[model samples]
Target: MAEPFSIKNKLTLMTEPAAAGHRMILSGISLRTGGTSRAPFASLNLGLHVGDDRENVVANRRKAAEEIGFSLERWVCAQQVHGTNIARVTGECAGAGATSPDTAVKNVDGLFTTEPDLLLALCFADCVPVYFYSKQPAAVGLMHCGWRGTVRLGAVRMVETMCRTLDLVPEDIYAVIGPAIAGADYEVDQTVIDEVSKLGRGIRNGAVTPHGDEHYLLDLQALNRAVLIRAGVPQEQIQVTGYKTSVFPELFYSYRKDHGRTGRMMGFIGMKNKGEGTS
Candidate 1:
């Protein structure tokens, strides 16, 4: 989606000023971001909770972090529940909190933090992985959006969460809709089609596609983009990957592709001011 990460793609990795303090690395076994495991998990698997060997996942994360100049320990992960819950991360929440003994600060699908050097990660298979960064507020956020979360206005919720809590305007924020199940492959029943169809005309027209009789294919990315626009983000300010996760099995792990037995990939973001650590 983002210009098909080429052999020269590595040069464009750190081009975004918003990503200067942190690296947004997407894996490519060939030309796409595929997990490095094999068979059910293939290579590049980044999820530890999916029955993947914890040690292997850890090793994969280590390489990803090292490629970007961050400690594998500095990247943080969350326990997601497909809800619209958004957690505000602080300096105290650094590193993967999955195995943390503390339970007081658990649960959430989206996370935001202004802390420099505190990277944030969220695991995804087919769900739309959304990343938000504000050049104005110097804050970053990650969200996992599926059909359930999308219907709950998860992307809009993330935007509102940042705008209301961090004094950020929608225009000042830039968002990217990462690789996910495109409409052509995401067939849904009439009930679901109806539910999404009711979400105003943009979704009904721009994101929904017919699939023979009682089924329909939904474009979660376009729907999310529409939600962002309705929430006040300028069209140009938002970037959509539009990459179909299920299409490229080698580069990405798709629950649909593997019948729900696949490992997950981590989409993360972190930021610091220019004068702070060089991300």
Candidate 2:
């Protein structure tokens, strides 16, 4: 019920409210705002590997960067292998995956960077967008958490990596569990349920419920929240958005709802450079 993501311009951009004196721009862009891709991908499709036109994907990425007041060359991304691999990015890694998927940081689902003016991005449809920010160290990270990544404690890994790499404490880190398919809309097999249960009994209790034989409704957001808490992030410092991608097809691209033939929305976070303004 907590609407942590505030819609700024219909579906173009939704940002987290400024809190704890931290003003890093954390956004989950929608599928309706920009881009030149065709149907299924439609418009505003930032992902290049989703069968959308490569040229359109490039155009869309450039448009997104321009809208955020950064050049496409400053955007950094990953291949998102649905694993727990975390990549520590620096200014030297700028434009790694900006224009082409092959140039993306290989085999990583999470990206952490202290460098300013560089956007950390991950593509998602139903997978959760886990965001991390540390005020003292002035760093930001973006993570892609699908079912596989969630079971592997991707959020926990990201937080731990940030704390170790940035020399910050978990209590000072602010995390946001971004939009994804809600439990009511996400049904999983017994194997997934068992895997998630490995997190602990407490995490398995309300996080998943039996739907039918060998099926359960899984709450990935809740599971990720528990993971963050167990990883030492304070409950008060974490924000979970209520938007469900599958339930809101008009404003988001839903892999499940669209039968896996859909586009992807991007989760982006970065610290602005000196004298740069948020639009």
Candidate 3:
């Protein structure tokens, strides 16, 4: 495997280093106080549609928004279906896709905006959260990359979409691969192993196991970074937060670690002028 990339966060919020002029904050609420009491849902569960208590999830999202200086009323998120569709944001369409006080967006995994006031966020649990930013064009984007999204090269596609639709150049973009299931803890079936191995760029020697039918540990973060590189984003421009969501249950939620019934964490990206900004 390549050298591991780590996501550096500021204060207690979960932020990624790869994205500049933006923040990738993650929530740290616990299950007992903030999460649903369902056995699988546990605590701090923010997914309202996942059978968690609606009131608690709403409260949690509001608290998170306040902490990050964004209005929950203005934040927009798509109903994620793991497809590669990327939506462009505008002032007239602000808060157009949010589902409820606890849910938003109907079927998009990628969100991009040059609109300064609209905050875009995606919910994650063991899925790789990717953040995007550009200095010259002055825009930011965020994406949720599960294994399906990564295998589909969603990270690379997001960069390309920005370049094609938003007039962003690859060299000016900074991509950060946020926390997810790392290679060591991410064991996959033979089919997945073979598919990733064919990618040729991310598969490391001994990353796969030959015993009992070829199970392998897939490195989603590294593979996603490879996709960004292939899309023309420089290696240094790609900041990786190799934090394992499964490893930090206290600070973030993990679907696999908590057995598919855990709370969610939010990864956000927004652009603000350096000297003159809105609070």
Candidate with the greatest TM-score versus the true structure: 2
Per-residue lDDT over 32-120 for candidate 1, one digit per residue giving the tens place of the 0 to 100 score: 24335565776667777787777776666666666554576666678888888999988777775533314323678999877767767
TM-score of each predicted structure versus truth = 0.85, 0.94, 0.83
Worst 10 residues of 1 by lDDT: 23-32
Better of 2 and 3 by lDDT: 2
Q: What tens-digit string does per-residue lDDT give for candidate 3 at 200-242?
A: 7444443444445577677777778777887899989777764
Whole-model Cα lDDT of every candidate shown, in order? 0.70, 0.83, 0.67
Ranking by TM-score: 2, 1, 3
Name the weakest run of 10 consecutive residues (lDDT summed) in model 3. Answer: 23-32
Error of 1 at 45 (Å): 0.9
Give the winner by lDDT: 1 or 3: 1
Candidate 3 ranges with C-alpha deviation above 4 Å: 1-12, 16-42, 97-103, 201-212, 275-279
